[model samples]
Target: MGSEKIRRWESGALAHAATDPFGPGPVPWLRGSELHFDDTGHVVPWYVSPAAPPGPRPATSPATTPRPTAGGPRSADDVHRQIKGFASTGAVTPGEAIDFHITVDPPQRFGVDIYRIGHYGGDGAGRITTSPRLSGIVQPAPLTADRTVSCHHWWLSWRLRVPSYWNIGAYVAVLTTDDGHRSHIPFTVRDDHPADLLLLLPDITWQAYNLYPEDGRTGASLHHAWDENGRLLGEADAATTVSFDRPYAGPGLPLHVGHAYDFIRWAERYGYDLAYADARDLHAGRIDPTRYRGLVFPGHDEYWSTSMRRAVDVAREQGTSLVFLSANTMYWQVELAPSPSGVPNRLLTCRKRRGPGRSALWREADRPEQEVLGIQYAGRVPEARPLVVRNADHWLWEATGAHEGDELEGLVAGEADRYFPRAALPEHQGRILLSHSPYRDAQGAVRYQETSLYRAHSGALVFAAGTFAWSPALDRPGHVDPRVQRATANLLDRICKRD
Candidate 1:
């Protein structure tokens, strides 16, 4: 129900939003009422970019691929450009090669920052979401003018590794420019699951589509990727460099990194051996992803590639379990390219005008492919705080009870029935593990201004944490909240029990 009742409250809430043009929005009393609009008009102004952080950006060069330079001699609104190939998800030729190009620019002023490359399992979680490896020679750091043509355009390549154990996931090359700007390129990752896995294929990477950045020059470092052997692979403890990270030097991808870290941590705590492998590994040897009982995803997961999507579909058909513990999971459109070293993959965020061609990252239709994880996005409501938890006592929440004042200030709670139906689960798979419970109003009216999940679909399981801010609320140390502990334990218990 992406309807207006919520919008009504939203318009009022914005006045106090951090981005508000005026002073703090009306106090809590005026919210959800005409008093919010009292003598003045709306208390908030239109949105504006947040304060820019101090950091370097990846440089681009037009020497390799076809494109204009970054931030140089361009149209007013066209400083960046999107990667050219998107439909290439299922088009890999086993060991075929491909090339990808992208560009980036500093937000403003007369300088440029040094940049790096990211190596992604690509398909493991779909979309492009990790800072895995780097490619090419000459890590050039050109200024704004020179970069538009020589530095901003990212030229990378890849080789598709169609491994025997391929499961739902993609291979990727992440292009990061000077000063921490990023984009994703995806290669399809293949795996063998039950022939019926196609049914669950759509969800393969749903739990962790991509690893989105939390903004600020500092990329999200809360994650690590592992391999099937229980061997530690990608990022590691204290978030040290990966085995190949420094050589690559790309900034970070989106939510995939953080999610991987979160998932691995949870897996270790709950007893699952998580490992990671690239297309090259699959190409050289055979793999068996089903050896593990479940595949995991963690924080801020957002992108998903077609290959990863297909592989996971097969895994589900084979009855493999998936545990998607993140939001905005599996959404980006990624691609892969051929390189002397390996294929380069990237996330598709050409939307940030400060980099590449200043393009947009608006991807529609993640719904059909992303439903496997039990969630899909309608669009981002920037810096929007969602009211979480309605049915506090649903089976998923049996271990805990709700408490007052556990949430951020000014958060709006919605009626149980009014969450985003457009993003709901099909009801045929699993069941609604938990919900953002809603209650009657002072006069006993229901308000559906919160977030909730419904479960359906077969083989795949469903577990929803109605509230959107889990890390700050529950996952961190000293951040104890009864509901979070109970819910966290419940999720692990269910996974173990089912396994």
Candidate 2:
């Protein structure tokens, strides 16, 4: 639609953007309590910008084609037991075939609708393709070996050969059963083509937190599991590794996935030249971070493989700017392994122990997160708190209209980070603490959070937004802050314009 319409929708004035009339009827699996989806099963999609559209479009579709909204039919609770699936790989390059292994309870037919997520004139997503009704069968139960729950569903229910001309972006495969149940399997379409920015989806962390089956009995993630007595098991007793061969628990969407969606909507609305990749791309050396001016980790990117860490470090050393829009980034060092069939990087392994020669917390491994991010995970905020601005006159805040000590309500929350003076730090020519926010932790003790920006010796700008609320503040309803939006734009603009 028009820019004014997009703005009105973002401000919650427009009730709903006209639906793409091409997709299937509302499915019960797509509905959720998130405000993005309205009562009528249509998605309002997240934030929008009033800026002029970028002159060029990606190769996926022409301007005349109508784009689908970000969501399909979903249930209010997103109960995913009836139908669920997972991609053969977290990402697929153009022209490559990716398999979808699905399980339909009680055996039923289903269809997979693929949608590329973006700003799409405020539609939020464009329906790329839909699969023919495929014969779906219940896959075998997941095998729990060494505390790892893996479903190597070798059934290969459906495979799609990505069109050679498809655009590079995040995509989702919506599994809608014949009975109206629906769920989501998220993946990325990647390419060697270079762009101004590279957005890395934290698929590793997504899988790490995925307690598939979530059914008390057969669920296990790297973070938690069930004991024999049926009591919850914490990290100390949880699975040491997790496999990507299974679908996500509950609604099948990763936790904090909306944060990434919010960012994609806001970024593409401005027509920023953006490319997409999965975290595994960095781990497998499939991505050359130097090809882009900036590398963005949009959500809770808490897990990192050694190779993934090296790639970003080398990219920054070569002057590629880095933007981390959420907190608790790179706190754990993980290792990626192949699945049973020898496919690469399908398994993530992490032992949450602190000691020398351990592949666990990076801080315990002598590589503190602050060494690169300029701040490390501080403590969890029991509730939302104001983000108190500090460097109001800094260039990043030029158009934000914020003043020193101004509190951006409820912007420092969830997990938070701060500068640790005792930690090993990277060399920076200059540094600034942008926000100093204080909130009570779960222990009832007050802890401070800080947003930071620092210039590496190679002239690359590294920004750490030290709070999980930062990304949601950019677009989510009730959390959007104009100051946060403008400051983010300023940071990104500087990244793109810097010599």
Candidate 3:
């Protein structure tokens, strides 16, 4: 920005900051905020004056019991008896430490092994960090009413401090016991630097969909259709609310790994200058979007906070480009509250459809996500379909000799998006539809989904892939499309050159 423009922007920001009673620090949780059950049977937010801290960790204890009676370390049937665990924080920067809480069927000595995830080889790649096997006593964290959403601090099994030399990327800690039972806990080592690209992981979406509880069959999540008890909800029956203070389920594969990692592995293979941050960073206003040429969202970034939305909008206004390599981006609104575990931004609260914390479709708020993403979630695609190039001449299709009539195999699958209606669009933006795929909506009516690009009046460029499968198709063998890879390269090359 020119000196005059920079000065004006800084002045305006300062004035805005001064008016915020919390100053420029991380926005503290509203004092005395608690979930109050009302006569309407809704869990509502009732803010009161300052109250005592919930504590540094959840106030519950793991049900410590000896290892399960079932035995057979080498037996395939015993797989279900393995241990499950998760870390307190999802992603942490080097030099910081994280706590791990575990639940063991048969309480035994467990070990924590950390590995950095990447495309190291065809055999698979994840280099073990120098952090030795972190051993601790494991116990069962039984599922009861008081401890459904959040797990007891239980035992702080292991606190691993990331060394400064650890590379910035996704890391998973493997928790194994002497009995041959194992599970995974994932975390990311983040770096703070000016880079060509900033990768924002959808931690919010991960926690919302995570159904990791002792009795997994009935655990809650933003996607689950039941309440804490086993009763089903009527509408989006999925738990409108969820917390991040518990472990994620399923072999520790962080919420369907194929979507996000496919893009990250491919990007890393080419050595793109990349920095990392969880979506919470955007909410906390910790990222200076102008410092990076582009911000990339990999996959399933469904839930978002108002602050995160504002941050991205501001960044785009300042000329920072954005690439949503996934569909269903910024669909629902949510709020962040301090975890009863005392971790800020750890509790994701969204009272979907009703109540004070009701998370209506962003469009209903007159803040349609499509205004920023050019394409909004239309509906789900019943099956995989070909993505027909609508604009062969667009710069994004520079290589691979794709023609307007050509269809990239299965590039449009799962959920997809289409351009928002005229009344829902923001001002001074020009859109270029790239690909269009037809699918059946929930109503059984034929609908078309569109992939698009738009340049804001401020000259910032935005690209939307218009499908959730775009990232997964990048490197997954059966789904990998060379055309998709080339198109992605074109986008990244242009953005990097702009820097």
| lDDT to native, each model | 0.32, 0.77, 0.65
Off by over 4 Å in 2: 1-29, 32-80, 354-359
Top model number, TM-score: 2
- What value of lDDT does candidate 2 attain over all alpha carbons? 0.77
Question: Highest lDDT, which number?
Answer: 2
Which 10 residues in a row give candidate 3 its minimum summed lDDT? 19-28
- lDDT (Cα, tens digit) per residue for candidate 2, span 351-394: 77833566588998789999999999997887788999998999
TM-score of every prediction relative to native: 0.42, 0.85, 0.79
Candidate 1 per-residue lDDT, tens place, 1-499, comes to 2432332112322212331212211111011112222113434321111121222212222211211234311111111221111122322433443334333343321111111111112111222122323332332332122111112233443333343433333334434433323333333444443321111122122212211111111111213222333222232321211111111112222222322333333333444333443322222233454554444444444434455556655555555556544344454533323322443332121122233442222234434423565544333223334345545666556657653323432232111122345553444543443333234445545433333333334354444333234422332222224465566556555644643
Candidate 3: tens digits of C-alpha lDDT, residues 165-262: 88887766766576755456767778776789988888888777665541323456665544555443343555655767666654444454446667
Which regions of candidate 1 fall more than 4 Å away from where they truly are?
1-263, 266-273, 276-289, 340-363, 366-370, 378-387, 403-430, 437-457, 464-468, 471-474, 477-480
Angstrom error of the Cα, residue 493, model 2: value is 0.6
Residue-pair clashes per prediction, in order, are 127, 9, 5
How high is the lDDT of residue 443 in model 1? 56
* Preferred candidate (TM-score higher): 2 or 3: 2
Model 3 steric clash pairs: 67-106, 67-107, 68-106, 224-238, 225-237
Candidate 1 residue-wise lDDT at 493: 59
